[model samples]
Target: MADEATFTQLKDKVVEVRHYIHQHPELSDQEFETTKYITNYLTKLGYRIITPEKLNTGVIAEIGQGKPVVGLRSDIDALPIKEATGLPYASVNDGVMHACGHDFHITSLLGAAEVLAQEKDSLKGTIRLVFQPAEETHVGAQEVDAAGGADGIDAIIGFHNKPDLGVGEIGLLPGGLMAAVDQFKVTFKGIGTHAAMPQFGKDPIIALSGTVNAIQTIVSRNENPQKTAVVSITHIEGGSTWNVLPEEAWFEGTVRTFDGEARKTAKKRFYEIVNGQAASYGVDVEIEWIEGPDVVDNDPQLTKWVVDETSKHLTVVKPEPSNAGEDFAYFSQKIPSVFAFVGSHGNSDWHHSDLRLDDEGLIPGVKWYYYNAKRLLAELGKE
Candidate 1:
């Protein structure tokens, strides 16, 4: 084990920061308070801070100087879920909560920032700490990247809090860490008539039902047996009353896939199925597709470095790829990156109304960040 005293001190700081953030959760692009807090903290640590023109709520702090700069990232946005953890430091904002453990991630990165700053004289190269916003909707990383966040970054590292794993364990996946997500909205229009005169009117509700059923076949029958694809119809709205035959029906849902080809194939098939089914039902249909984040692909060399270096501080495990998506995929696309998971030690699922995380897990996470930064700096020194 590492020195208990130093680790405990860092844990204490993590608790303070985490609670502070939990008590003041902000949503997506509106993270003014969160950004201010991070900016103030990092500035106090003697690091130069850069505020990009486009991203008002993002903060990038740099320490040390030289080639092959490494980057550390943390998302500062909170979900819209209401706080139900009942902790004293629970969110004061109604209908908003830190359900995703972003509070802990920011705290861990801040902890690393403090340690790295303190040891800058003994370190080599640079470390860029990014405090990002709007990760819940998977747009923050792209915004940051567009603003030249990783202009000359050699490697970017990030971590999510995993409630399924026990505390003190870090999970790293080499290849696909998370799937790509896409959302779609479809509407069918038809003639409306009395419910009793079904033969006289074309009901869009009927077409919607067929559309939903056929969309499922994209995953079950159309997709390859070895590949994973998810096509879910999460919402459907048609008739307002039982006595009326609705003129129009709307449905929306999301699709998730690991590979780009699978994602494209699923999207193409979805549009075809919806249009074909609507045409057969003699209804006019409109489909809108919105592309989302891509898969979180970890660079093999950087992932290996993370695994090897993290092993020196705590127990580490390789986890399977997750279906959920993250905005960190944007950073991974630009530079070498590895997004790992730090154990949260709770049973509650993420984005749930009652999600909670073990506060003690912050200790190991802080240590992991500290060691990872040190190892990166050391590696840069050798080059």
Candidate 2:
């Protein structure tokens, strides 16, 4: 943890940074101004700034040199949602808002930066503070890694603000905390014909309907019921007019699963259903699979180290497995990493413009960041 002086400094500056960031929010892969602001802040603190051209936008600052450097990541990009919070600090940028509490995330890391920079002289190892962009689209972590953000880093730690839990509480899961996500789209192509001539042409709509129904069996009839999996069709598009059939019909959705075997099986079966249905209907089927992050298999040792130290300073809860996917999964896959959630209970859910979390409520998260960093660095030396 930070010294008393450093702690006090962080405690005082947390709200100011959060409020400013909340007002001037930026979108993913386009955090130009936000990058400039954070760069200036870290530069003034005397940390060596590392923003490679490939990173596009984001800042990687290093303090205290040597082996076993720890990487800390916080996604800085905002979402494209109009603000409706009515708070004076609500998003000033129209059609862009930090609806997911990324503003709070940036503030917490900035606060941690203040504490770390103040005590760097007495620290044992390096702390690489990474402010990542494009997390909403799940490409920020990849961008950072491409920019060598994790090069030579011994381990990493990151956290998110949780709105369901009460203030001062944290949620940490040890294994399979979140699922792997796969989004897919299928287009059924057929000859368009007038509605009156029912037998004139193959109807892609009939084929699409059959395909969607059969795909659902991937989770039910095809896969083992004992395992967890999900297949949902969220969007479908077809003919524009009532009496005329369109030449193409398209549908898209996502699949979520905790079991790797189940995930593969689901995709394999989905393709089978689409192909079989298209063949029977004499239609052409085109499919695309957009692979996202895999299951968040939290490193057991790293998670234990975090919980052991964090439980001392704050209330830590064992969270149930979630289906929500995170790009941080990419980092955890490469190095020993732990993704945690800090309580910032609000009246509305995340991704909603009406979301609200008091600045005072997120202080424990700030303090936890310092504690986790110190403990991880200290533990690395013992190994």
Candidate 3:
């Protein structure tokens, strides 16, 4: 266990950094100001900073020197949601806020960096601190991977704040932590017709109605009874007037699955149901699939490492698999990675305008990263 006085000192720094980031929120890849703040802070802490050209707003800082480098990651970008928390550190930028708690993630890493820097001389292996950008758009992890962020990295660790969990508790899911996310849009084309004479032209609105209803059957009938998949048609637009039949109707929705086989099967069934229904109505359909993050699968061994280290500082609980998606899945693809969740103690859901995190829960998160890196370095023969 760390000294009480030292822990208090580090916790104070964490709060300072968190509040600073909370007040000034940047969105997605356009995190110029946020990147500058992180770079300067790490440099001041005496770490070797690497700012890759590919990710203009991403920063990777290292402390100590040796093989089997352990990585700690945090996202720096904010979402496009408006803040209604009424906290003094509420987002200063209108229409932008840290609703997902990336503000705390980055600040926690910053605090860990400070502690790691103090013990740099005694450390055996290196710690790579990754300050990522555009996590809301699911582009940061991909960009970091492309920029060689995972090079020579033996194992990676990351965490997100969960509002449903109680403060001082850590949640870990061993196998499939999060689901794969994919989106799609379908456009139905038909002939326009006047309101008085319906038989003269084909009605796309009628075809869309059948398509939506049939799409639901794909989940109920095509998928296995045990397997889970979600297909939601969130948007539908078509006729301009109440009586006139429009020439086209557009529908968009998302798909979530746990495994590769399930993802492939769901996509196949979706297209078949949508296109088949359109053809039956004598209407042509165009379908477009938007790619998203893969499911986040934690390495069993790495999960154990996180659980052990987290237990030292707080109460740890194993959680069920989540349907949500995370870009961190990209890193898990390259190396053994563990993605855990810190308690947020909020009643509202994530990505909501009123989403708020318990500031007190952040200290334990900082300790987890700080101590987890120490344990990982020891295991890798760096300590």
Candidate 4:
């Protein structure tokens, strides 16, 4: 346990920094100001910084020396949500808010970095701090890895803030902590005619509706009943006015699954169903499939170690696997990694404008990052 004075000071600093970041939120791939702020802060802590050449929006810094590199990461992107919290430090930038508690992630990692910096000389191996960007779009981790972010790192640790859990509690799962994400956009093109005349035109909207309903079968009938998969059509648009049938209609949505075979099966069935529906409706069809990150499978051994050590300091829970997509899956694929969920004690869930998080969560969060990295470095040094 941290001393009261050190804990209080760290908590105060995290809150102040979080509020400043919350007010000036930046969207993915456009986190220039956020990058600058993080760079300046890490530089003052006397860490060596590395800015990836492929992108100018993310920051990576390192401290300590010698072998057995360990990484701690935090995402640094905001959503396109308007501020609804109405707090004093609510987003000043319109149409952008830290609805996902990324501000908390950044502050916690920064707090850990501050304490770790003070113990740099005594530390055994290199500790890399990764401030990843464009996570919401699911490409940041890939870009970072391509730029050699995880090149020499032996192991990495990351965490997300879970509103469902309370402060001082964390969620840990060994395999498949989060699902893979995939998206599809389908357009049905048909002849346009007067709405009153049914036979005069083939209605694309009808085809779209039929396709949407049929695609649900991908999960219910086509996919294995025991496996988990989701197909949700979240967006649909067609027609200019009620009087005329539009020439084209389009619908877009996402698919999530844990197993690679399940993901492939769902996508194949989706294409077939949409094409079959289009043929039956006598409409031309075009499908755009956007493949995203794979499942966030935590390293079993590393995760077990996390559960054992973290349980000693905080309340550890075995959380159910999440269907949400995370780009950190890319990093996990490359090296040994453990991703946990730290409790934020919020009433609203992630990506909601009304989301709130207690500052007290930082107490456990910073300690986890600091102590976990320190111990991991020591353990790696032995091997």
How well does each candidate superpose onto the true structure, as a TM-score? 0.96, 0.96, 0.96, 0.95
Kindly report which residue stretches of model 3 are placed more than 4 angstroms away from their true locations once superposed. Answer: none
Better of 3 and 4 by TM-score: 3
Clash number by candidate, in order: 0, 0, 1, 0
**C-alpha lDDT score of every prediction, in listed order:** 0.87, 0.87, 0.86, 0.91
lDDT string for model 2 (59-140, tens) is: 9999997977998889899999999999988888999999999888888888888778888888889999989999889989
Supply the global lDDT for candidate 2. Answer: 0.87
The list of candidate 2 runs beyond 4 A from truth reads 1-9
Task: Kindly list the per-residue Cα lDDT of model 4 for residues 230-282, writing each as its tens digit.
Answer: 99999999999979999999999999999988999998899889999999999
Check candidate 3 and list the clashing pairs: 124-382
Cα-based lDDT at residue 37, candidate 3? 94
Question: In model 1, which range of ten residues has the least summed lDDT?
Answer: 1-10
Give the lDDT of residue 364 in candidate 1.
Answer: 80
- What is the lDDT for 371 in model 3? 86
Model 2, C-alpha of 189: deviation from truth (Å): 0.5
In terms of lDDT, model 3 sits at 0.86
Clash count in backbone of candidate 2: 0
